[model samples]
Target: MNAPALRLALADDQALVRSGIRALLAGFPQLEVILEAGDGDELLAALAGTSVDVVLSDIRMPGLDGFGLVRALRARGDATPVVLLTTFDEDDLPLRAAEAGAQGFLLKDASPEDLYEAITRVAAGDTLLAPVPTDPVRARYAYRDTSAPTDTFSERQVAILRLLAGGYSNKEIARAVHLSEGTVKNYVSEILDKLGTRDRTRAVLKAITLRII
Candidate 1:
């Protein structure tokens, strides 16, 4: 079947791995890689006006690293899709990626077809992580004690906060809750505001603490 075209970028620390990924992607004409980076810093440097539909990046890299770079990008309000291509979907990485607003977290050994599909799915605004409550990856996200008092988030903020905890993309939550994607984004912003949290996982932890979700 013909797949939708995707403008792509690859970031990894290893040269051979980058070349191999490029070679594999070359087999699929629908996937066009516009640029490549050896590390997170390079990825950041290469992003402006690169016109990428999706970014495939490693979980761990030198300098800015995967999670940090993804967090930075999302923080700057870049809606461009990002998928982590890693050797192992380390427990923390998935949750961290979710919290960082990454569109997808996928295993590196995933077939090229799966990789290609992930790029398409994320670019289309879908969550790539499997759905199952209490999954091991979710458990890996540590919930530490907070001595501070709980903040009172409104009902809408709490609702979006729970979906964020469940690793739902903004697009997914918008569909489920009968709101627009931009509105969901605003709800997430309110969640961050009322809970005094910086990112998704922190919001999750705060919700857990406050018994809001």
Candidate 2:
């Protein structure tokens, strides 16, 4: 039997952008755009009555933009996976998105294949670390004067950091790295401390922003 279609919600201030995305997603029958909204407030209002497997939202809406949307969802203990989209690929944006509880981040110009992969992965409960552009100036601006030693991660820590970037949980990371789950947890905590972050998402994004992983 075929799998059921993945229901989706889209929120963007621009009607044309929402329509364009809805139209693009039309090519994939398994991915359905079940609801659409103009901003985070509208989306939240609809979400009170709607159920969706994933939310694909523009980062900048007129009200309660994408970061706020994710934060709101998390605050309500809603675990629905959210993928944030933006035209600007600033180094700090992905970090901010991660910190806000977004499961994935993508550039608006990303190809259909990329979009499909992002939606599917996040729907499967995986966080995604977007590729960071190489810009030393911007990198310095984003992570300057941090207490974390940028160049001090050991090889083992680096390997674990890479797996964290791939959104592996403690159990998955333990299996991949041949460590106990407890050990993985310890390593993750150390990684966060080394990166000056309070959570796994921020740790991974900060590592990427600093070119540490």
Candidate 3:
């Protein structure tokens, strides 16, 4: 038997953008937009009674933005995965979203296939992030000090960090590094510890900030 369609909740302050996304998603029969909200507050209220498989939220809403929404959902013990949509590739937002428990992040102009893949991946308990170029990441998030104290990662860990910033999954990273998934997981944990962050996304951001990768 085929799987049921996944229900999605969309939250964006702009009505036009929301409508555009809704129309775009309407083409995919496997996904359904069950609820729409203008901000995080409305999104949370709407989610209280609805069963949604994923949330696609704008990061800069007027009240209770995307990060705030993730925190709220986590506080309520709602494990519903969230995919933050943003127009700007802000340096700090990715780390903030990761800390707030967001499972996915994508640019507003991402293709339909990219959006679909992100939703499906996050729904399946995987994290997804839009690939950001390393130059812009370094320029936007890098600190002035070339020799920072936190720049202590092995060459293999640095390679893994680069893949992580490119949004590669643990399995994918394992394949790239020719290592087992379990070993890759250990490397990721070590990388996070070295960066003083708790998640892959944050580790990537910190690595960029410190020029570790």
Candidate 4:
């Protein structure tokens, strides 16, 4: 039997951009656009009456932006994955998105294949961030103050942090590190604790800020 089409919700303040994205996504047969919202408020209202596999939202919008949307969903105990769309490549944006519980982040100009992959991966309970944005983010955010107080990280933890910065999911990180997934999860949890952050993205940012990785 064939798998069901994955349902998606889209939110953006710009009508033209929304239309463009909708048109782009229409090419995929295994994906279905179930909801379109003008902003986070509309997206939240629409979500009240519908179920979706993933949410694709612009990071900047009027009256509740992408970060707000994710924070709202998480506060409501809605675990629906969110993938942030943005035109800017600022490192802080992805860090904030991670703090808000977003599962994916991508540039607005991401290719159709990258968009599809991000949606599918997040729907499968994996996190993703386009590689194009990650390297620049790391380069720009790399710690420079060697005198700053920093938490000590083991070499293995640093390796995991590098993968996290690259947006690799726990399973992928496991493969790269040659460890079981569960063990990687433990390492991730410890990393979070050491960094005093709640999620992987924030952990990476903290690591960069402190030059721990």
TM-score per model over all chains: 0.60, 0.65, 0.66, 0.65
Ranking by TM-score: 3, 4, 2, 1
lDDT digits (tens) for residues 1-213 of candidate 1? 776678898999999999999998999888889889999878877896576899889888888888887877877777788888788744555556666777677777767776776777678766654312232433465356454434566555655665676677888777656689999998888777766678888878755654454
Instruction: Provide the global lDDT of candidate 2 against the true structure.
Output: 0.79
Native-structure RMSD, model 4 = 10.5
How far residue 75's Cα lies from its native spot in candidate 2, in Å, is 1.0
- Of 1 and 2, the candidate ahead on TM-score is 2
Which consecutive 10 residues in model 4 have the weakest lDDT in total? 128-137
lDDT of each: 0.73, 0.79, 0.79, 0.79
Model 2 poorest ten-residue lDDT run: 129-138
Residue pairs in steric clash, candidate 1? none
Model 2 CA deviation exceeding 4 Å by range? 131-213
Candidate 4 lDDT tens digits, 142-201: 644334324577757765676688677787767655689999999988888777777776
Candidate 2 displacement at residue 42 in angstroms: 0.0
Pairs of residues clashing in candidate 3: none
Tens digits of per-residue lDDT for model 2 on 1-213?
A: 999999999999999999999988999888999899999999988998888999999999887999999989989888899999999867567666766877778888877766887888789866664532235433543653345554487656866775676566778666655689999899888888777788887776677666674
Q: How close to the true structure is residue 47 of candidate 2, measured as C-alpha lDDT?
A: 90
Q: Model 2 Cα displacement at 94 (Å)?
A: 0.5
Native RMSD of candidate 1 (Å): 11.4
